[model samples]
Target: MSSVDKQLDELKTDVEQQIPNDITVTDVKYEGPELVLYTPDPKRFAGDGELVRKLASKFRKRITIRPDPTALTDTTTAEEKILSVIPEEARVTDLDFHHDTGEVVIEAGKPGMVIGRHGATLREITKEVGWTPEVVRTPPIESSTVSNVRNFLKQERDDRRDILERVGRQIHREQLGREEWVRISTLGCCREVGRASFVLSTADTRILIDCGDKPGAEGEVPYLQVPEALGSGANSIDAVVLTHAHLDHSALIPLLFKYGYDGPIYCTEPTRDLMGLLTLDYLDVAAKEGRAPPYESEMVREAIKHTIPIEYGDVTDIAPDIKLTFHNAGHILGSAVSHFHIGDGMYNVAFSGDIHYKDTRLFNGAVNDFPRVETLVMESTYGGRNDYQTDQADSEANLVEIINETYEKGGKIVIPAFAVGRSQEIMLVLEEAMRSGKIPSMPVHLDGMIWEATAIHTTYPEYLRDDLRDRIFHEDKNPFLADEFNHIDAGEEERQDVADGDQCIILSTSGMVTGGPIMSWLRHIGPDPDSRLVFVGYQAQGTLGRRIQTGWDEIPVPNPNDAGRTSTLSLNMDVSTVDGFSGHADREGLMNFVGTMNPRPEKVLCVHGDERSVQDLSSALYHEYNMRTFAPKNLETFRFK
Candidate 1:
């Protein structure tokens, strides 16, 4: 190696020595104002604030360490600057800056107090500074009080579980004496996707179908942990099978480890990759907000150690009496619908794990089989009357037209896209449109995790469209490599260019405008009547995207500076949505899968979709199949035999 290279290596070694043994540096790069270090260990910087300050002092320049993609641990002045402007009543609890990606996060408890009435204080903070402020509150607890509360809750939960177990055993005894029946229960079904947590158990083996989280506003989603299910199934579980990599289907897998469950987590290869990406990402988000993640980084690592990557159609015996197989769910890349064969008799069950009946440029349609399946656990993400499809071609055409029109009027277009699925879809659409001359070729900028994640996607090509994957594998014509696209990883300088560009389309993440590079773009472009901000995914309730979608003319966003000020940026830009890009199956597609299944299922439970979607889908299923269908509320449990 050259002298410079050698010196860099030496620097790395020295830096490694300074960091805790558990924290492994993934990358070391220089941004404008700081040297940024990334580590996969979420607790790398926690409780080591003094060590961080010492390191920063040695550098004399700012230093940032990100344990996860969305989190930062640093002694940057941005937070202090922002804090100065915050009202006295609004106390700052935690502040972090992700220098590698220019993510400035300020988290405070009692955010409402700091935000003031009508978000006046918040507006002042954002307008003055660029830091994205996220405020959360934790109910105060004395150590003694907390212990008492914990014990009480634990005892109560244990009592309930004991009662349920006794009843379950009685039922099992009766069923065994006569005939026999399998019992199933689903946990962690977020209502937005018609996804659920399913538990299936026989005399010999018990299995968790999917584990996940509910959707809500940032800092508002209290942990939805079902200790009874996890603890009960821990020692005796055959395996935990993941359907897809989406958070609602996979987020809580680490929690299993936290609760002393060490069974293998079985998922598709792509699902495995996505889980690694997501679990780390979630840790960063949680850390930045000064909230301890529901599961620690160590637990995530432990979970990873127990993961077994299974390809679709590869049947494996997770237990003496249980067998597992995965089929293409045709949602996002690597999504799967799981099938389980249990017991010696005629007991079998198939779970449609966020199924996508519609074929896409990415994945094939879900399989229609299991002729003798008894019970079906399915999603209703699009299970409502309002859920339908706009042709993909038409949606792309409309998207191109909007961009062309906005650019013709000398406006820039800002699209807040999800980093993984929606970002890839938008990129594909843009590439096609630009190639077809539907719109002028302007610099298309991609920010946030999309660019990095796209590279990861290429590593697992089988999860994508077969034809596209083959072409890229053999001939090397990667569609993700559009000529007009540019990656923006530099600090504020490259951002300024995008902001000042005459006609450009900038795609950034925190699709809901909740955080990430999108905030910077919004701060710059949101006030421009000539600019357009297009939201291409679902905006969960209480997100800035929802506010914009709901026609709020002005909204309060995070101030880039650490000062506790806010900005009331004018929403002069034309706000729009292209819902077709969602990775979810629409209502018609969902219904089609349910309607066409072979031999039909005896019972169906629909969750994960919005209330309207779930109910409509459930109603439709009831009308058509005359089967038991339900749309359960959060934390609500149902037993099936």
Candidate 2:
């Protein structure tokens, strides 16, 4: 027998020995780092909740209980029973049945109502209908991306199951050799701040972390041409661990699938959804700009099919020698600090992916505590000596002051923001400022993908800061659903009308003014002396936003009167940049993170910044903490063990 099959047999025998005989076990199989046991009498098995916990503890793996196909009730009857069990207040929107997993997904407006006070309703549904119940929340604002992803997953359930099975087998396969040495190769985001990727490997396993690409730069993909990055080729990569959904950290993942990479992607559930939205938007933006996208949309769909959504704090076995765990990065929704435990505690490495060590209006501070970490890789985005930002309160006050001044001037306020993190943060700030009368209430237009991105954020409230999550859970207090906020339609006429007609605030995407609706708004507002252009996020070098920040007097834009013609619009608008709204840790926060880390790391690798910033941060860390530190460039490899 194959080693994997033999190991499965042993696991099955062990489980059968522990399970009560009344609960007949039909099969035990691996399902992507989880061991799912199919039982003919799942209801009976469910009665003893402690049984599954005990099995998980004994096996040191995730355990799930599912009813055998023969044991599942008919779909029609099951739906009726589920509706009967759940309260009408739940406002169930969709009922999806997955026969392969014997799971009925119940999407409801109030998931708490569907789950009852203590999961009594859910247990009753499972007990009465012979189908495991999974509850999902319907966002207050409808998100077509969320809806489409859910529907697509349901439709492709069989294929997804097959992929999970294959992944499970690979994860459980016996190691061919002992892990003697560990090495890390920096592929990108070392000397520069985009295309963040790293290759971590041992003698027996290989893993890729954060396959990203630089935005607005053609041919700026990670150094996959390096043999160490390719290892034998794309197919040899065992898995991909995504940290967040930012285009800078997740855009080029589809290229891997296009290049014959068929492997499981481990990420938080919201990261999966948000990355899909951002990547599709990236393609749309590229096509509109007459740039050829690196990969086809089909490859993105393939990547989605292979993704395995893992919750924070869940320890998952990704390879024979490496176990992965994610912690809250606090940079954006579903951002994670990836911690890898390799070779049964032989070494531990932590990679901080765009960490925000201080709490923002959106999320809590990034997690600094880990059980063990010997080598630490961290971002140095704001780690330059002079990269200090104002306090949060001061920053918010500055923004309010800017808006009120612009309001008094009867001019529009244009704030260019990244749709995912900064846009949502600005919304909350504006919502509160207007509500408190600090800034006059006016129409707040959400253009480009900001509306859709906000919808995705609402769908995953638990990922937000504690107070924001609580406010969202209580419907009336939800800031995102405020009446003052308006989602601008895709029609150019509507956008132009908003730009020309309103003396209001506009939050638009392509934060760096590289593309998207921001460009259109700038063209209309640039020449208006009363209008103000405010930047609340980092403007990467070479972007138009940076040029404007550096006092560019005029810009060449596509002419409306003549096809394929260009015109220069004189820039007369007041320009301002608000600090302290960034999603990255400043120098002080970076230093604090290292000092406060539990059991401080033996060595540090600084990355995700310009050459000067990386070097300064590395020197500061080495001197302050007196730890071994290096600022590695792309294609640099270091052996840890």
TM-score to native of every candidate shown: 0.69, 0.98
Stretches of candidate 2 exceeding 4 Å from the true structure: 116-120, 559-566
Worst window of 10 by summed lDDT in candidate 2: 557-566
lDDT of 2 at 397: 94
Q: Deviation in angstroms for 112 in model 2?
A: 3.5
lDDT of 2 by residue, 378-403 (tens): 99999898989899999999999998
lDDT value for model 2: 0.89
Best model per TM-score = 2
In candidate 1, stretches whose alpha carbon ends up further than 4 angstroms from where it belongs are 1-180, 190-196, 218-227, 231-238, 563-567, 634-639
lDDT of each: 0.66, 0.89
